[model samples]
Target chain A: MVSLRTKGSFLKLYSWLPILILYISVLNEFDFNYLNLEYFSFNFPFILIFFFTLKDFKHFDYILVFIAGLFNDTVVGLPLGISSLSYILICTATAYLRNITIRPNPVKDWFYFLFIISLINSLNYTILTLFFSFDLILMSYLVNTFFTFSFYIIFVSLFKYYLKGLND
Target chain B: MASSRDDFIIAIRSAFLKKSTQQKFSLLTLVFFSLFIIILSSLDFKVIRYSKAVINELVYRSSFIVSVPENFIKDSFIQVKDYTNFFNKYKKNISELESLKSNYVSNEITEYENRELKELINDYVSSSNKILAKIIVDHDSPFLKSIIINKGSKDNIKIGTNIYDQSYLVGRVIELNYKTSRVLLLSDLNSNVPVTIAPQNIQAIVTGSGVDSGKIKYIKSGLSGQLIDDSIVYTSGTGAIFKSGVPIGKLKFFEENSTNEYKVEFYSDFSQLKYVFAEIITQTSILPTTQESNENSVEKNNPLDAKLKILEDELNIIEESNKKFQKENENLKSEINNLNYKVLNLNNKISSQNKTIDQFNLDTDELKFLRLNLTYGHKCRKSLFNNKGFIVGSAGYKDCVLRKGKIDG
Candidate 1:
């Protein structure tokens, strides 16, 4: 009976790992920036939000995701709510895609993710430049979008492994 | 077509309105809330500002706590890299330290003069207290190059407070919370500083290139031609945004596509900053009142005394150099005197040797005369029978002996 209770607590923590990782990513900004590679950055929160929201993960709360956006803005020194808006838009895009699809396909999902991230990045670039009068390099946003899109498949595979372990 | 349109509308509405069982808010509600927060953040409302400051205080602390492990890994990596080049860096630092030591006194003099000039121009005495602040978050974000320091309004850190790595200008504080402030680095695209390029004295604006360097802009036409590479760049204090004459970077000139490109390579590397100094300036107006007249009198005397002290220092330096030159001159004079004495001794020895040689020649001639007397002296003697003979003690007799008794006048 004691071992069973311990196992249940461990399972609960494991199930909430995505949101926990989301908060940590926003706070810590774990984007390999210390590598000092020029124009090399990817939005980890964007990928995490899109994937989990598309699958409709039980513990991945929309409110928590929005708060994570606020944390991201504080960390990155952006205007508040900008990242929150972007995250919510991603959640909406993934949600709409989830509702429309009858059968899931990873390749199709990958391409759609590319399209979605590209559109979001364009919107981000536009908003930052036009609204906030922020001086941002268009090439940096483009490169960031490209790298995030490329890395999605690899992270998705790992996320799939996590989900499989949860189901089992 | 109507059916397809209806299906699209249904999917869109579901995406916006539907919330999962565990979710507290729908996507549509979150979207509007984010928009509201964004607009609210832009406005200068006192309540919103206070709330934002509170949130910033909490978030910055949380971020600092969460970034500890990553910081450790990064610091370890940097330590390893630093160790690899430690010896070379030490050697370079030794050379730089020597040059800096030589320049230190002159630089102090220049600083004093500059302070006096600034006081004369501004009619106020501004005293700056530099508080050491630890960099809480240095993520090196590519979009906006900035760092969060662990000092803010509570520590008298204002919005445009000048941040520094040692004495070199790093950036200025852009956002100030209660205990944290964001410093916008000179490498950010939004950062622009008015600077004077040295040796040329040309004034221009330096804008960040969103990289580790800055671009020189707003230079007069044809003045760009006069710009030389490796010239110094420092703040001009124009617009009163930054303190004047603070060393910023070095001007690097390169030609691209037949056009000259100039970049200011900052002296302080933004990525490596772990701690910085935030200058808290307090200005005291020098306008004299009845109560402040005594203080004004003291202040007035201070500048004169300072000038006298500087002049005294200059005199001391000149005297020190003069003393060194005199000591060298005395040493050289003693060496020359010793050389002259040795030459005189040599001349005396040579004269004595020449005299000895003359004496040896005279002795050999006398011996020859004696040897000849045994054989030919009898025929050349005064009592001798031959009339062609020379006198016995005459100079002609000695000459005849040297000539082997051939008596010729």
Candidate 2:
């Protein structure tokens, strides 16, 4: 037995499922890499959406971004938190975008979110990667994010079907 | 059955009330998504792992339901195969027996009796250390990755413990829980074995890069009479990583031109895998020369890192190949629409890759070293262009990948 508030918090955590699935699927293809823009490496937006989608993400989005970045930074196996900072900036911009964009369209909202997230993710990942400056197939990451975001949007849309029923 | 006037009154009351059903539903949906977002951002994989277990339960339950027909079909096919094989053996044995009956003198040789003598060896048992485990769930995903074993820390299974099937090296223990441990298959990306390339004291690394096949790299190719296809690639587990003189894989297709690849087909069949014995030792003394020093060992990365990388790559290919001509031909042609559609699929793939990496705690110095070489090669090219006068700006597109994964001094 849990309070509705606790349950609500718990459910918020559950949203991570879709994102986690997204992260893992991408990771499988790319691998723990920066130089190879394949599926397994964490590109910019992957980190961006990834950080934003975590639990307790509402407050201190920037801190969450850096903390999340540490995992990659630690494992990027070099000067850590470069990806974290980059990811934070992406999330920050997203929050700003969310505030500014006041259209009441969920589909449009998703598209806008995806576009901004993609741009920021790549930019951040690219900037951090310059410190190490290993050549990756930059196009590959771009394509991957583009498709990954689309898939995320589609998967997200599917949930609407069930929720619509539940609401009824 | 209610009238429009009644509906309007109910709706009015609902709107003014403390909470409306629609509002509650909206709040619930918001809460659910918010919860998901929060959970995701935490990066504490343990909870996600728990969630995955619930998902696995659903998947397994559904898979069991759906696989009923598949099993029936498979079982029928196997029955037919068994009957045919039995007939062949029985026919051959009957003929042999009949021949023996006609030819033998005093007492005809029975099928069981006309066999090799059973040599008995004395069983002298002493102190023994071993851990027992069973494969509970096969990795639902592909990639010849890792298998989840029922044994965990409770069973004394620790990371880096060697695992075996009867007499062959299968994999090493990478992750462990209280009652379950995940065995990193010898065929997983992070799995690396330091083996002595028999007959010739050639020491190299045998790493699992894919399913059905593993690569034997780092050996100086064509040193003597080495060709594309050869026989007998036995494991000389030089670095105490595995038992000496065990079979890892067989020499399969060879890249005659490239010094990098010696593709060998993996013999340790994960498909037939069921039970395993985990060796608890943390570090294998095998292959000491090339083994990574502890000081520089990278922590296990989230598999998500790997997946995101792949998506980025796919995008890059489309942009590169489709870029120049597309803008000219455009009415927003969406040249490679498939690329756009794959967004979620790519993300999903990336996420799973992250999960797998996390599951096995994937870490690779070899990969790290390889990445380092790319950086170094760029540095070297910069230095070379600067020193050798190959024209400064033109060297930007030198396009180099470090050969041999060698770490530069």
Candidate 3:
């Protein structure tokens, strides 16, 4: 009986791992920027949210994701709600993608992620520049999008391994 | 085609309106909430500002707590790197210290002179005090470079307060909360500093390139050609956003697409900064309006008083000049005394040399006379048979011997 209870608790923790990781990533800004590579950064939260929300994971609450976005903005020193908007928009896109598809393919999902991120980044650039009068480098956004798109596949594989473990 | 389009619309609406079982708010509701927040944030409402400040305070503290482990890792990495280059860095620092030490005394004097001159020029006396603050969050984000410091309005950290890393201007406080403020680093894309390029004295704007350095902008058409590598860039106090003459960075030139691009390499590395100084400036008017009015009344009542006041100012200036002149005169007097002493010593040396020369001449004459005597002794000697010369020891005999034993004809 004791062994069964312990296993159950472990399973619960494992099931909630995605949401926990989301919170940790937002708070910690877990990008390996300390390596000091030139123009080397990727939005980890974007990848995490896209994958989990598309999977429609039970524990990946949209409200928590929204809160995580707020935390990210605070950490990154951006205007409040900007990150929240971006995140919500991503969730919506993934939901729409989920609804319109009968059969899911990773390759299709990956390409769709690229399009979504590009659109979101362009929107971000426009809002910051036109509304906030911010002097932002368009090239940095482009590079960020490219790197995020590239890193999505790698992170998605790792996340898939975790999900498989949870299911088993 | 019409059915497919209808299906796509239905999918979008379902995505927007539907919420999962665990979710609290629908996607549509969250979207509207986010928009509401964005609009609220953009407005300069006092309540919204306070709310934002509270959120910032909480988030900053949480971030600082969360970042402890990462900071340790970063510090360890930096420490390891530092150890590798320890000896080289020490040697370089020693040489730089030596040069800086020589410049320090002159710099202090110039600073004092500058202070006095500024007091004379401006109507208000601005006193600045730099308070040290710890950087709570320094995430070098690629988009917006900024840091959160543990100082805020409570500590008199107002917006536009200049932050410094060891006296080198780093950035300024843009947002102030209760106990924390956000400093927009000079490397932020939004950061624009009015700087004067040294040696050339060119005025220009430095805009952050979203990198470690800043790019020079808005310079005169031909002035960019005059900028050389390592030319100093400092705040010009043109917009009064930053204090004048605060060193910002050095101008660096790099080739891009067959054209030279000038960038500012900041003196302080933003990434390595842990603590910074926030300068709080308090300005006091030099003369009160009441005093000015009293002076005006006095001048109108008696023009002589106005003349006397002018004379007093003139006297003060003259007194200051006189003190300088006195110092110069004292220096001149000491110099003159030294020169006079040197002249006396030189005269004594000349006289001694003249006496020695006279004695040498006399000795030479005696030696020549003796040689002549050896050759023509009998011809000039005065004796019982030969009485052509005077006595042997006489002056006349000595002269005649020196004259080659010849008698005056």
Candidate 4:
């Protein structure tokens, strides 16, 4: 009976790993920024949010994701709620896609992610520049979106492995 | 087409309002909440500001805690990389250190001179205290280059306080919390510094290139031709945003599309920063306590006025030196007077001693004459046979006494 209880607890922890990782990513800013690569950065939170929310993972709570966004904004020194808005918009887009889809395709989801991130980045750039009077490089945003979109497929495969383990 | 339109509406509504089993709020409510926060944060409300500060305090601490493992890994990686090139780096550093050590003494003397000159030019003496602060978070964000340091208003770290890596200017504090502040690195897109290029002495504004370097902007036309690579760039202290003469970077020229472009490669690597110094500056009026109240009424605002003040100081120095020369001249005059008085006294003493010597010589001659008269006075007697003998005191009588009563022949 004790062994079964331990197994159950371990399973619960495993199931909640995605949200835990989300919080860590937001706080840690898990992008390999120290690599010192020129014009190299990707938003790991965006990729995580898009993939999990599109799959509609049970433990990936929207409220937690929103809070993560706020944390990200704080860490990145952006105006409050900017990252939250972007993350929520991603959730909203994924929800709309989920609602309209009869059959899901990873390629379609990936392209949709590219479009959503591009739009979100554009909106982010506009808001920061026009509203907050923040100086930003459009090229940096373009590169960020490109890198984030490119890294999504690779991370998605790993996330799939996690889901498979949970199901097993 | 009607069915498709209906489907689209239903899907949009579901995306906005629908909540999953484990979800706490619909996506639409969160979106609106996000918008509300953005608007509220922009407004300067005391409550919002204080709350944001509190949130920032919490978030920064949490972020530091969360970053420990990652920082350790990053540091270890860097250490390994450093080890791979340790010997070459050591050799280079040794040569660099030797040169830097040679320059260090002159640099300190110049710093002191600069401080004195600044004090003379301005009405206040600016005393700066540099307090060491650890970098709590340096994510090196591509969009906005900034770092969170473990010092803030509690540590007298106000907005615009200059941060430095060693002596090189890194950035300034832009946002301050209670125990943490955000420093906008010089490499940020929003960062603009007024700088003077050495060797050329050209004034220009350096704006970050949204990368690791800064681009020189707003130079006078035709001055770009005079700029050479590796020229030093330092803060001009214009607009009083940055302190004057703080080393920022060196100028590098790159060609883009057959056109010359210049960028400043910063002295401090923002990526490798672990600790920094935040300079807290306090200014006090330079006037003496006795004259402060009276001088306070006088205006010393413009450069011309400062020049006049400097001239007045120089005049005072010249007056002091002149006074010293007059005192020395008075001393020399008294010394000459004392020497002349001594010379006159010596002359009187010498004359008296000469008179004594003459009297002594006369007494000896008289004694010799008396002895000669006992023997030769009979022969030399004027009344008897010696009419040739004169009086004893006369020159002829003295010579006859010495000749033992002999005649003139």
Candidate 5:
């Protein structure tokens, strides 16, 4: 029942993409280790790519991106608000890419969003763990990564339906 | 369109000023987190784990529900611990029992002695007419100062039948059913017996304190002192309920006040009672009414006669002592009367002394008047008679004026 402007609608979904990712991943298992699973790295960047492929650089779009990433950090218990800022930068880059190039398939364009942001998340987790120096079992790291990716996939799939409705 | 954009920019700038949804959600989360921490700490899981005291289950609805899973989890863990402990204890008991069994030819000897003792008891009991039964351990009562015995109405262990231990009489069977009977300890609240102790031959009514110890109350209030240590209390058998010479308890201490009543601390350890037996003695013969009346009459008359004899002897003794008291009393009375007479004499002398003082005062007044009148006459003679040619007339007029002033004053 709620309507959004075409640009606003796309920006809103783009911003919530990371929240979707964190929800699916965190709910299944809340371990925030980055290098724990090799397979999870495959789907990780798809959500991040979704953010970077947005058409415009409206301040509101960047804000949504920031909020979504921050929410992901909260739900997944990642480093406090770092992801939100990284995600806003990712959104800016996607706007530039959209301005320069042809709009690609929704899946591939979105995969860039997933791939890049997850890479950033992984890097952040590694840096955080290095400082922490607590002994963690290898299985726990794998579980965290797998859950995070899986959580992202399910919420994004649901989010794609919202995106389709917005476009229509 | 320009105005809408300006408005939009204003809204965007002001967005940070508005409290964010994150702030509100974080507050809720903080509250929930605090609640979780309080619940965990307040439950005191460590105390519940280690404590031997019975655990209280229902602190609240959440705790009650929480405790179910917690108890189940703890139960399995504790079960293992208990099993290990039981195994260790079982091994220890087995070893000790084995060692005891190895050396103790005394056990066999005791068994043989027990059979022989039973034969001896049987022989004695046949002659004395008594029944002996082993104590059932499960029949003990934690709440009541009583116990149920194996023998009951079926065994003819009737009401008022005396129950005893290996060497001492314990109590009596008060309530009995067909197969089991409840015997009230002498320490029961409602239980009372008149006990006469050995050595001192002291008599006291021993009653239960509704606790483990029997109390001896109604000790002679006006009696100078209290129960001394190691005073053995025994059954007086006044109601014919207890056999005389049954050991009750030693006097621990007697607390007394102006009321003359005292509580006697008992030395009998009631808590560890292990073996007890009851003796069904025959019902005591109640005294006939005529005999009881005769005994009462004799008791009354005898006391009266003894008092009368004591009174007469006391009177006679008084008569002998009266000689001394009589002379002493008379002397005292006369001395009192003489003292009264002396007091009266002293009063009269005081009265006479007061009269003399009044006479002295009158003499002083007369002397003063004489001096005043002579001075006045001298002045009148000099001034009026010598200087004036009309001496008699001036002197008479001055004398008349002086007389008038004296009369007026």
Candidate 6:
């Protein structure tokens, strides 16, 4: 009986791992900057949120994603709600995509993610520069978008493995 | 076409309004909430500011807690890298240490002189205390370069407080919370510092290139040609935002598209900073306590108090210079007196030598007369039989005998 209870608790922990990872990524800023590569960075939270929300994972609540965005802004020392708005917009885009599609294709999803992140990053750049008067490098944003888009497929594959394990 | 348009409208409606079973708020509501927060944060409302500060305090603490594992891994990686290059780094550091030690004494004297001059110029004496702060979170974001430190308003850290890595200026505090603050590094794109390039003494502004170095901007057109590599860049303190003469970086030149571009390489590497010092400054005015009322009356009567103050400072400097000259004059007078005393002793010794030489000449003449008397006494000396001779002791007899016995004939 004790063994069965332990197994059930372990399964529950495993099921909640996606949200846990999301929180950890935002708080820890899980960009591998220790490599010391110039102009090398990717938004791990963006990839995580897009993949999980697109699949409509049961435990991946939109509210939690919103909170994670707040945490990200605080960690990155940006004005509050900038990242929260970005995260919510991503969820909205994914929700709209989920509604329109009868059969999901990874290639179409990938292209859609590219378009969504580009739009979102442009909006971020516009708001920060116009509203906050921030002097941000246009090249940094472009590079970040490119790398984030390119790394999506690799992260999607890893996330797929996690989801597959959860299904079992 | 009508069917596809209707489907699109239906999908859009669902995406905005629909909520999952586990979700509490619809996507549309969250979007509005985020927009409201953005507007509220920009407006500077008192309650909103307090709430934001509270959130920052909580979030920063939690982030520190969450970053520990990653920090450990990062520290381990850096430690391993450090070990790999230990010998080379040690060799370089030893050479640097030797040069730095030589500079240390002159630097201390200059610092003392600078302090005294500043005190003389400004009515208020500004004293600074640099408190140590640990960088709790250093997320090298692509857009913004900032670091969160474990010091804030509670530690007397205020907005615009200057931060340093050792003695080199690193950044300044922009946001302060209860126990944490954010430092906007000099490498951020938004950061601009008024600096003076040394040796040539060109005044210019340095703006960050969103990278490791800063770009020189707003300099005089022709003066750019005068800048050379390794020229020291230090704060000019023009706007009073930063302290004067704080070392910022060294000037570097790189060719971009066949055009010379100047950059500042900061002394402190922002990426490698683990601990920093946040300088807390306290200012005390030099108020006239003794004759306050009289000074106040004089200040009110004279519109030229500032000019009078300048003249008073000049007078004080002149008086100090006069005192130094007086002391030097006294020393020269004593030196002259000792020299005159030596000259008098030399004159006395010359007179004594002249007297001794006179006595020796008299004795030589006497000896010559005695020798002559022995040889020619029989021929010229006076006796009972010879009336032409005189006594030997007489002056004429001595002269006649010394003349080789020749008489008047």
lDDT agreement with native, every candidate: 0.90, 0.51, 0.89, 0.90, 0.50, 0.90
Give the per-residue lDDT of model 3 (tens digit) for B299-403.
Answer: 768756765675688789989999999999999999999999999999999999999999999999778877889997777788888766678787887777777
Q: What is the DockQ of each candidate?
A: 0.74, 0.01, 0.66, 0.58, 0.01, 0.60
What is candidate 1's lDDT per residue for B250-345, written digit by digit as tens?
999888899879999999988789999999999997666786566556657677664465467678998999999999999999999999999999
The estimated TM-scores of all candidates read: 0.81, 0.40, 0.84, 0.81, 0.27, 0.83
Model 2 gets an lDDT of 0.51
Error at B270, model 6, angstroms: 0.4
Interface Cα RMSD per model, in Å? 1.0, 14.0, 1.1, 1.0, 23.3, 1.0
Alpha-carbon RMSD, each predicted model: 8.6, 39.4, 7.6, 15.5, 35.1, 11.3
Tens-digit lDDT string for candidate 5 (A92-150):
34544454446556566546554655565465455445743322233433444455455
Candidate 4 has an lDDT of 0.90
Q: How close to the true structure is residue A131 of candidate 4, measured as C-alpha lDDT?
A: 98
Candidate 3 chain B has its poorest 10 consecutive residues by lDDT at B302-311
DockQ of 1: 0.74
Regions of model 1 farther than 4 Å from truth: B287-409
Q: Which whole-number lDDT from 0 to 100 does residue A114 have in model 5?
A: 49
Report backbone clashes per prediction: 0, 92, 0, 0, 28, 1
Q: How close is candidate 4 to the true structure, as a TM-score?
A: 0.81
List runs of model 4 lying over 4 Å from the truth.
B287-313, B316-409
DockQ value for model 6:
0.60
Model 1 chain A lDDT-worst window of ten:
A29-38
lDDT of 1: 0.90
Candidate 6 local lDDT, B58-117, one digit each (tens): 988888899999999988998999999999999999999999999999999999989877
Candidate 2 lDDT by residue in tens digits, B291-409: 33231133115435434544576679869878766765674556566667788699999999999887664456446545755564555344534453222234232323333322232
Report the error of model 1 at residue A75, Å: 1.0
Docking class of 3: medium
